[model samples]
Target chain A: AQSVSQHNHHVILSEAASLELGCNYSYGGTVNLFWYVQYPGQHLQLLLKYFSGDPLVKGIKGFEAEFIKSKFSFNLRKPSVQWSDTAEYFCAVIPLSGNTGKLIFGQGTTLQVKP
Target chain B: SQTIHQWPATLVQPVGSPLSLECTVEGTSNPNLYWYRQAAGRGLQLLFYSVGIGQISSEVPQNLSASRPQDRQFILSSKKLLLSDSGFYLCAWRSGTTGNTIYFGEGSWLTVV
Candidate 1:
């Protein structure tokens, strides 16, 4: 069984502030990584995905995540955040081999960006 | 383009009542379908998944059960509802091809009174 751990359960930041949310997964094999965001009262949307060939992946709304295999981490980051960026973010993963598209998701981090 | 639809966007059922939620996918074939429950302030917990028609897999033993009568149609049902079942139920689909990107439907809010 694979599991994801999100270190930051809740985060508060002012507009234009840099942001970083920690995510780590427990899987040894090759995996596909993803970050999804859910705005208040909105469905979950894909922010970005990492299949292969890139350790650093950039996503929508100026968000990015770096996948470090050695540390089993894929941390989401944004240089500058806006008030509209307030949402719940989820980190997910799927093993590359023998995967039936079952995605293991983290507990999620709530980001509150204040103006 | 592929899209997923789940019926009864909001449901309020009484304890010991029955539940039946339907989900279907369009614009794709032989895709994998899944059912997940999201409790307040928690991550999405996968309840069931299916690879093909009449093939279902259960992740956790709970009061819910899932079935796939058609390739793109997935159903979640419960014989008797429990208060613990109150949460947001989401239906998602993923292409069985190369990439592993899963797309979610507009979740159904279930409230057990």
Candidate 2:
């Protein structure tokens, strides 16, 4: 079975700190990558997505993710994170081979940005 | 623009009681609907997905079941709820044309005591 892995379970950072959340997948075939954020008591929102082309993709709220096929990783990064950026982050993947629209999500990382 | 809505934002039920969570999508047709369970440290578990009306695919076999009676509506239900059924439920949909991204709803919180 295919799986998505987010190594970080919990992280704490002060405001304006650099942020990087690691994400990795099991499959090597063609895949779509996504980063989603869930604020406190809120639904999940798309942060960034990497389908094809340029390894690096930019998303809302000054967040980006780099899709490294060789490493089988699509890591989320932000130069400076704010308290508002504190949220649980989740990574998702959808395999395109004989696709049936089944999406797999990671365990999720809880980021606490201290003010 | 498209949006998904889930009902019973928060509910508390006793074990052995029936469960029904409804979801509806607006501004899209022939969309693929899905039901997910959000559990601690487990990420988003894909419970059921539908490509068309009355066509449902279940990922995990559990006490829960799903039904898609309409093209843009999906429902998750259980004949008898269990204590383990207490968790957050999310409804999502993706366009058959774009089919690449899935959007989630506000989610329903169910607590079985």
Q: Which one wins on DockQ?
A: 1
lDDT of 1 by residue, B1-113 (tens): 88899999999999999999999999999999999999998888889988889989898999999999999999999999999999999999998875768999999999999
Chain A TM-scores for all candidates read 0.96, 0.98
- Quote each prediction's TM-score: 0.97, 0.95
User: At residue B72, what lDDT does model 1 achieve?
Assistant: 96
> TM-score of predicted model 1?
0.97
Identify the runs in model 2 with alpha carbons over 4 angstroms from their true place.
none
Model 1 lDDT per residue over A1-115, tens place: 7899999999999999999999999989888899999999999999999988879999988999999999999999999999999999999888766756667889999999999
Q: Kindly report the docking quality category of candidate 1.
A: medium
Candidate 2 chain A minimal-lDDT segment of 10 residues? A95-104
Clashing pairs for model 1 are none
Q: Write model 2 residue lDDT over A3-83, tens digit each, in one string.
A: 999999999999999999999999978888999999998879999898899999999999999999999999999999999
